[model samples]
Target: MTTLLPSLPPQSTLLTQASQVLMHNYSPAPLVLTHGNACTVWDAAGNAYLDFTAGIAVNTLGHAHPAIIEAINTQAQQLMHVSNLYATQPCIELATQLTQLGRFSKALFCNSGAEANEAAIKLARKWAKQHKHPHATQILVFGNAFHGRTLGALSLTPKEAYQVPFAPLMPSVKVGVFNQTENLDTLITNHTAMVMVEPIQGEGGVNVATPEFLQALRRRCDETKTVLWFDEIQCGMGRTGTLFAFEQVEGVLPDGVSLAKGLGGGFPIGAILVNEKLADTFQPGDHGTTFGGNPLACAVGLAVLNELTQPAFMATVRDCGSLLHEGLGQLQVDFPQLVVDVRGWGLMQGLALAEDQLAVGDLVTHARNAGLLLVGAGGNTVRLIPPLVVTPTEIHHALGLLRSILGGV
Candidate 1:
């Protein structure tokens, strides 16, 4: 790959300008990233780092993938943004691909995971009003679940810190303990409009929902005529060695599924896939977005799906995931005092650190300083979400870096 470093202001000057202009919502790292290729990114100061974060598991093919870049450039030149009233080929084709892959009857495109989840909430309310009682509007979500940061999705997320600051969130929302199948009957009732959950909770410490628990939720939702939706924004699009995390569970098909993150590689796109039962819940004008299904985003999304759905892509994901998991497990064995647990499936793994021994943020910072990037999740866990196309050599190199960090600690 050719490297053409663009002329720019000093890193310190840029950081100061960003602090003055941008909001203080995020306390970002000091590095000013310039460009990337494969699994590595170069900062403005010409410092290269292995990107294990993969933009929080959004970069399906890593940086500067040929397919994604071609799609973006080609679609931008031909057609970019048009109103939702006008249909585009890329939008229609992308929807067809998603419905076919997910075995869902229909799809609604949006610009982000939060919007997809918000659409699901609206669809559930409308469906309940028409089918169930008028007051059947309660939504049931599990604890430690992160749907999104928007108001509707935030209400579903039970984290006190993220919720308390934005008080008086959406009403008619109920919380349940994740994987607690014993309380399904009490949690999901006739008045429940929808039951949304993450098959593998990403932000909530990479928690995996058991197959039995999902089976119970499916049965109860059927009995009460409630919609069971899976928020696959973080775990979908080959992140979990499958197209969707729910596929690994037996007889656990959801009524609806929300998707984003890796769907468009790095381009922003989200969608809501619904089964035949709830396919007709949303009418033509029920809900929409201005730039949801724009040609450029859909084109890039199609390119990403094309690459992910290749014959050997998923098998490679499984193999790489096993390798990564093995490395993490070895770390647990080597550093029993610091690494308390290693959990998660496929490439979306997490290393839970002992709070008494070390802080997750400290470990992440140490890794970053040592030319590796990592992200911290809930429960004092450090997420290792690398690109799906990462090679064995890269995985080993990352493990070596992590081992060095742990040894120093």
Candidate 2:
């Protein structure tokens, strides 16, 4: 993975030029990343850091993997963008793979998790309007659930910081406690068009949904004819040791599910898998995207899927994921003054910090300076999501780095 782009200026000069031109949407770290391999990345200053953030869980296969690079190069040489009006082989093949895996009949492609969740929202609402009770237009979402920042997805995301600037969101949204079974029975009703939930709340402190609560939601959705949707943007695509995180829990299924983050291995592709019930509910003109199912994205998506769905690769994820989870759990016990709790499945984990310790932002900055990248989730959570291809050695190295940062090891 040699440098493909032209090298010119130092980190400070490059960052200064970027600041002059680029928008201030994101507050990035002081260092500028140049290239990466496996779970390690190099800054412009030539310092290498072990990456546990994995670009916020978007880089499924890690940076500059041979397969993903080949897919990108091959697709660039052949075809790139095609409007949704026409069909492409890559699109067809990728959709087939995803639908077959989810046991769904159809898929709607988009460019991000927000768009995928938005598609799910529209499909559920339209289905409710056409078939279910005409008055059934309410939507149920859990607290601390992060779908995306898009208007429709943001409306359901109940975080104050993210939703404060954008007020007057969609109406009829009833909030339910995630993993709380008692509140779900009464919170969801026939008036609910959709009940959107995350298998594990990634940005919301890595809180996992209880199997009992999921089963209860499934039963209630069945009884009320409401479409059950899962926002697997951050937790899906083999991150949870399954094709879909919901698969790990028996007797629970979704009418539709949205996917995005790792689908194309950081190539920016999204999709919604709708079961047979709402498969035919969407008409041709109901929803569409111009650049959603383009050939380049689909080709990369197919390549990533080909790599991820392999039996051997999945086994590695399970083994490596368990090791990572256990290491983090041990960290919690080792630093009770700093760590409040540790929770998650597979590699998508979180460590909630004690109020007495440093803020998550400061801790993340300290960890970054120590040559280990970590991201802060909502609340006092420090998120750790390494690439699926991360090795046992890399996991141990990351844990050691974290321990060193916390004044141990």
Candidate 3:
């Protein structure tokens, strides 16, 4: 048997040592980053990389923004985490801000996308049962969708590799084609609990649902009692140059929205906002969390909300997003063989490769060597979700790096 190791090892030696100590859950890249500044991170080796992944779209304001640091420091000095029984100003204010933007009646706080989704699933089933559609426990999800890794979310995930080993997933989940409205009609019936969708699917190769499709779903959900839930954990929080990607479409609002990632601006937080009619579905004893909605996380979440809601800030995202999209569009013209398609809304962008997934890896690794970090998804696509605060200069540089790599490929 391998000998046990200590936990206080140096950062340089941590990965190797931790591999033996910790559970093998994830296959992280071989870089041990020690610290970071806005839109950039430095490994223990002092190698710098422009962060295009943005902590998988978690660091919305980028690493260590001055305002974020100040908020966290001040909040920590005063209060970190108090029990949820005591209401904090930050928590109250954030709820107010979120509710103001939409028709959501109440916000239930949690600590991750998976947990928020779990809460949503439970709430949906309970609501359906109470409404007398007891058999309406089936949830309709899309192919190539990812909600989280928890059992409920994993059960909804379409990826086989993440689910086959963890068999015996929660039952009654039906899979449908994303952006295919006709298929949704066939799958969703009176027995369907809820129809969960991602406005701009982040992990599913950044596929943005057509406006017609979302409108169709919204109409159908309204007619039927099936709750319309949007898993905006990755595509929401101003990533699409708006508070939520659904806003991009006219007359399409979800009954509940599952949020995380950018909402806390790096601090771990998740929430599910339910409309007025469905808000009371859960009774007091129905659900609770020990660490969810703690003061520290709420404080950071408020800070992120405040900064992201600024009109000027959102305008910059729109401008920068357009520039990046146009730049990538131009690049696609020259390397048609390398780029099968380019899609995504705002900062949640992706490049579909003409070749196989292996070639996408080669291109991504080459990008890393050129001082840019990227993440890939299913369907041979590489995501380019840079920090929302990324400057045009950085975008141009990143594009140049991609050009060099694509030219070679």
Candidate 4:
């Protein structure tokens, strides 16, 4: 069976072959990437694209960065995997660095954003059961939110497109309007175990949450004793200029934070950072994973985190992000019909198209053809989640290509 298939298909046939062989889950972009350099990827056809999407914001330091390559190579030469029974240096070091970043006192490593969110859900429920209320289990999730695809994470995701077939999800999950301060009061009851939200709504079209809203949530959670979980998978790890998006706001800290995407700089690692009190919920035998804290992944993650945490590195991100955001907003003034609004913070930006103007997928496909990789999000938005390492010059080049495409559209 293995020998029957071609080793690799040509550029023209790759998409078609993938359709026939792979599951009908993702509506992938048409470009078939052959290799990637810093902030740029080349298609098999030899066309280069300024990667604004950054593999959906996973490649924080950009593709094939020298530091990342070195870390991965050095770790591969030493050890790969050791069971949770024995502690590994990379994992211990990475966890210590993450713990120092904020009020989070402990870290639970996983392999993806979904897995991290799943761990958060379990920790939240377990904490509630043991410390707060034995019967408290309900969780409050926001509308248009995307946590992950796994069953437990899926339960927290409210999008119908991701939930329809997998009906009868985990019980006691409620949907609340985002940024609505009053809604939290109604949604959070004694039975609520946790209230989950993204600091800046990523899949929900880059909507920024007001500090008032977060402050309200913090107050409500304090009164109700509910665990507050912030899903920072897409927007964390310097994707939003800051190490975490919530850091920009005053009095906006969560009891638990789930992070992935950019944490490994494309090496694939996720984590749940818990406050000191909530850290004790998980006992030894309660939760575990075979590949969670492997040395290779932790080494890569450690490098990525170290690079992103530098003050000078984040200052560059802020400058670049400001340049990109202002450039796009100015374009909105010229092409008001094609673009309704441009909004976001740092490199995690988005352009919302006018109602009934054009499908978001069409814009994404057009950008790919023009050698600029972009991704679409909810509410007819085209997300511009470039790598944090992207420079002002790269942002200008990418936006210029987008402007050229917009003139034709």
RMSD per candidate (Å) reads: 1.1, 1.7, 4.1, 3.3
lDDT of 1 by residue, 1-409 (tens): 3343768787788899999999999989998888999899988777899999999999999999999999988999999999798999999999999999989999889999999999999999999878987988999999899999999989998999999999899999999999999988998887899999999999999999999999999999999999999999999999999999999999999999999999988899999999998899888788889998999999999999999999999999999999999999999999999999999999999999999999999999999999999999999999999999999999999999999999998
What's model 4's overall lDDT?
Answer: 0.88
After superposition, which runs of candidate 1 have C-alpha atoms over 4 Å from their true positions?
1-4
Model 3 RMSD to the real structure?
A: 4.1
Candidate closest to the true structure, highest lDDT: 1
lDDT (CA) for every model shown?
0.93, 0.88, 0.87, 0.88
TM-score of each: 0.98, 0.97, 0.95, 0.96
Model 4 regions more than 4 Å off: 1-9
Better of 1 and 4 by lDDT: 1
| Tens-digit per-residue lDDT, 117-230, candidate 2 | 889888899999888888888899989999889888899999888888998888888888888887666777778899999999988888999888889999999988899999
lDDT of 1 at 308: 94
Q: Which runs in model 3 stand beyond 4 Å of their true positions? A: 1-12
lDDT of 3 by residue, 98-123 (tens): 87785678998999999999999999
Worst 10 residues of 2 by lDDT: 1-10
Candidate 1 lDDT: 0.93
Residue 320 displacement (Å), model 4: 0.8
